[model samples]
Target: MRNRMFAVVALACILVGCGGCSTQGVARQFADELGEVALSAPPTGATYYLQVDNARVIEDAAGDVDMPYCYDLPAWSEDGAETSVVFRTARKLRDGAYLRFDAALLRGMISWEEVGYDELPDAVREVM
Candidate 1:
């Protein structure tokens, strides 16, 4: 009975592991959003409003670590018809990366998420 249970659990683990990396298909989602916000049907290249600064490094048990980094990504539409915003950051450089904000990604400031992540108290959300 125990052998049978172990085999079943092992098979489940193997199947789960086959899903591979976590951040796949990200480009496709971005591409779809670009189509909506572009005049050229897919945004012929982009001018990113990204600014990299002094990111922190944190290490934990099991030797797993996180490089603390955060970014504020906003966009101005062609012809200036509409403006959209997003706030992104990493609590960890790996799988924990995420897009988190509230109330439509406000004017690059006044976000509780930005003030608290990545061991940074005063990032000042760079908008390029």
Candidate 2:
């Protein structure tokens, strides 16, 4: 009986832990859904691609800490739509590096990650 209980608990834990997994398929689906919406309208959410360029450093005067690097950059959507977005990071991003951003109108940039040049869509690659 104890062995069976342990097995069931282990299975439940594994299932719960995997719930937060973010796969490429999930990101693609999210981008696809958001792509259908017009960019002029209030952004629900969407994926954006951009190449790193200049950044503005925001200093924290309270103490010597990691200052956030901010970028107001031109971005492209999955379908090659264009827009501007502002995002921040603790460290300076490498010049010419490509990134994928999950963003909303009100929220600005929700999350972002560096990606290889090949991951960029054809439209973005042409301009970047």
Candidate 3:
């Protein structure tokens, strides 16, 4: 009887511990919003730009790592002229070597506008 009781307790502990392994509520919401914006059809003739800051993984970085990285995804509409910017998830580089698709900077995005490359943060003048 003691052995059976121990087994049941162990199972309960394991289940409780597993809860912490799941994604946080905020992270989940960020992902859902990003996916909705990214997967949605682009406005007619509009271009989609992903403006991402460095993931900030390093304590002290130098050179290009400090600059803002932006990637221009294909247009959702061929006739659209609108431009949209979406911040990338922290630590996810624009053209980094890794293949991560689960991170985004913000839970929401702003409207389309003509934002100059130089006007971007970190003096980012280059776009990928």
Can you give the TM-score per candidate against the true fold? 0.21, 0.57, 0.24
For TM-score, candidate 2 versus 3, the one ahead is: 2
lDDT of each: 0.34, 0.67, 0.39
Off by over 4 Å in 1: 21-122, 125-128
Q: Candidate 3 — what's its lDDT?
A: 0.39
Candidates 1 and 3 compared: the better one by TM-score is: 3
What is the C-alpha lDDT profile of model 3 across 1-128, one tens digit per residue? 99999999999999789767764664455445343443343333222433333443233234245533333232222223233334332343543231212222352343343344443333122333
Please report the candidate that would top lDDT against the real structure. Answer: 2
By the lDDT metric, which is better: model 1 or model 2?
Answer: 2
The alpha-carbon lDDT assigned to residue 2 of candidate 2 equals 100
At residue 18, what lDDT does model 3 achieve?
Answer: 78
Please identify which of the two predictions, 1 or 2, would achieve the higher TM-score against the true structure: 2
- CA RMSD (A), model 3: 13.2
| Candidate 1: C-alpha lDDT | 0.34
lDDT of 1 by residue, 1-128 (tens): 99999999999998678646432454335433332222322323322212223243223333323423333333332222223333333453333322222232112322333222333212222222
Error of 3 at 31 (Å): 2.8
lDDT (Cα, tens digit) per residue for candidate 2, span 1-128: 99999999999998778756854455445444333222332567778788888544333434335535555677788878777665556777888888897877445567788999989988878776
List of clashing residue pairs for candidate 2:
none
What TM-score, to 2 decimals, does candidate 3 have?
A: 0.24
Pairs with steric clashes in candidate 3: 44-79, 44-80, 45-77, 45-79, 45-80, 45-81, 46-80, 55-91
